[model samples]
Target: MQYSVLGTTGVKVSKICLGTATFGVAPTAQDADRIVGAAIDLGINFVDTADVYGNMPVFDRPGAPAAADREPAEQILGRTLRGRRDRMVIATKSNGIVGLDINDRGLSRRHVIRQVETSLRRLETDYIDLYYAHDPDPDTPMEQTLAAYDDLIRQGKIRYVGLSNHPAWQVTHALWIADDRRQQAPVAAQVKYNLIDRSAERELGPACDRFGLSIIPYAPLHGGLLADLRVLDREVSGDQRFQGSGFSESEIATAREVERLSRAWGLAPYQTSLAWLLSRPAVASAIVGAETVDELHANATAADVELEPAQLASLTALADQPPAFQHRAGDGPERPPATTSSDPTA
Candidate 1:
């Protein structure tokens, strides 16, 4: 039930953000209701969704599923929000695919404007609490993207601006442009961060702190890598939805430490992983997707689990190895300025 302000936006969000990449699929509206309802019961007020998040469990791949198969995650989430709109902080992204046309994607002015309007309609809301540029769109100039967001803020279509899967330099660069131009700067940055994957800590973490931008880490469980790696050895259920966060030799080494610490703390590996993420700097919230109501409740209760300072240090030291692998997006020192039609944004 703990909460923190989203960067410097003065908006309070739950420590655990409910990620809806699995919506409209396995955990359909009926199951989604149970999961989201449990999250609300446990005090989760932050929810993250992307326009191209339907049909599958995750969206890190590009163009495999046709446009017809991909349903907007926002639409599914929007329908579920019905009366609970005011009870949660709603966040959705653009710069992803809504159609097969060339102009249906990217962070260009035309695309951003058109996407936001459609998102507003599909979300069944006049304003989105937070809006994100799904990823780095190199084709479009940064100023054009910022200007589009600026207009949205001015028009009351979106309150705060943010980015997902954007690197440290790109974030700082955008902030520089926004500050210099007196435009609305981003309040948050979302990335694939978890106990097993600490790449964002190298540069993005420091940049976020310096720019007064909070970090909303998606895939906080590392595709169930932090959830539990036993499935790698033994054929365990619930490993399908988490296949995106692949495993590696070094990652398994760190995950072993996570299990040991979890045992000592008397908590599940997933819960311990989430608690560790909540303890990081500039981390406003950590987004975790749950398949069932029980899973949702378990993940939400991680907010109450606090690791001792020494314990956290030990966990960090174990996870401080070289980048072995990443969730869906490979661990690269520099992520190219790329935004795809399949914005699973997981």
Candidate 2:
């Protein structure tokens, strides 16, 4: 596995970070353990998860059989990493209105402090290497949230803080606040990027470039749409791609075209999509979810799928279209290119 510096932080992280959302959500603890071990064996040093991830029911239902032993997701992950804490850069998030109480969610000082303690306890870690505000909290002032993050850094509870699914302006303001206040600056920003999605290019992409924030992109393969036609069909039916906002029919067709190009290039559709994502320097890691070792191995091998300039150009041109909302002069559907951002609160 190859590695890259995470933004200006100078921390070396694997280009392919293993996302743990699937680890404890559907897969049993034993299965999740094997997957985590497999990821480590493959040299993946970054793992991403969230407090909300633990609460997701299997098959998206309200109540399903919990993974073996019925442990919460974070607890299972913590148990799996019993003696390997220092071996990986673990990142997680907070900010979901988990319960009906007001303090149960949002990025308020009360919530951030309370949640961090809960997260550390659940993950069996004293300090979180990276902490993220899952989404913009309209209820909480930016200064209040930044101060809370500052307190964590000062207390050594979190090494760095980041924002996901936030508008560029908010991210920029937070960075300035941290700088002026002389607090720990956000070292990274996680967004969504894929062969079918280029929306980040407009604001977040450029913002990261100017601010030197590492991009931990999720759904690098458009949540399996670019994996294969069957998965693409399932994704369309499920409306879970693009951070669960679903995709246009034209977007689905465009995803299929990307898959066809991958076959023509003698690569797995997923590999091609991942390889394309890795080519960009701003991306610190692409968090890909997998259920088995075979799937993990296939994704890990994407590091070797080098694309020539010509092939890259062809794939980009084919998938590069305006957002579906745009209209064309000739009256042809102005299918928008695929674009995904960090997972927003739904």
lDDT at 232, model 2:
42
* Model 2, span 59-172: residue lDDT tens: 242233543435556677888888998898889998865667757888889898998998899889999989998877766777778889989999999988888876577677
- Candidate 2 clashing pairs, residues 3+ apart or interchain: 196-338, 197-338, 197-339, 322-336, 323-336, 324-336
Instruction: Specify the highest-TM-score model's number.
Output: 1
What TM-score quantifies how close candidate 1 is to the native fold?
A: 0.87
- Which window of 10 residues has the lowest lDDT sum in candidate 2? 337-346
Q: Estimate each model's TM-score.
A: 0.87, 0.86
Q: For all the candidates, what are their Cα RMSDs to the real structure?
A: 6.0, 7.5
lDDT of 2: 0.75
Error of 1 at 58 (Å): 6.5
State the RMSD for candidate 1.
6.0
Clash counts for the predictions, in order: 1, 6
| Segments of candidate 2 deviating more than 4 angstroms | 57-71, 232-248, 321-346
Off by over 4 Å in 1: 56-71, 230-245, 322-346
User: Considering only N, C-alpha and C atoms within 3 Å, which residue pairs clash in candidate 1?
Assistant: 59-344
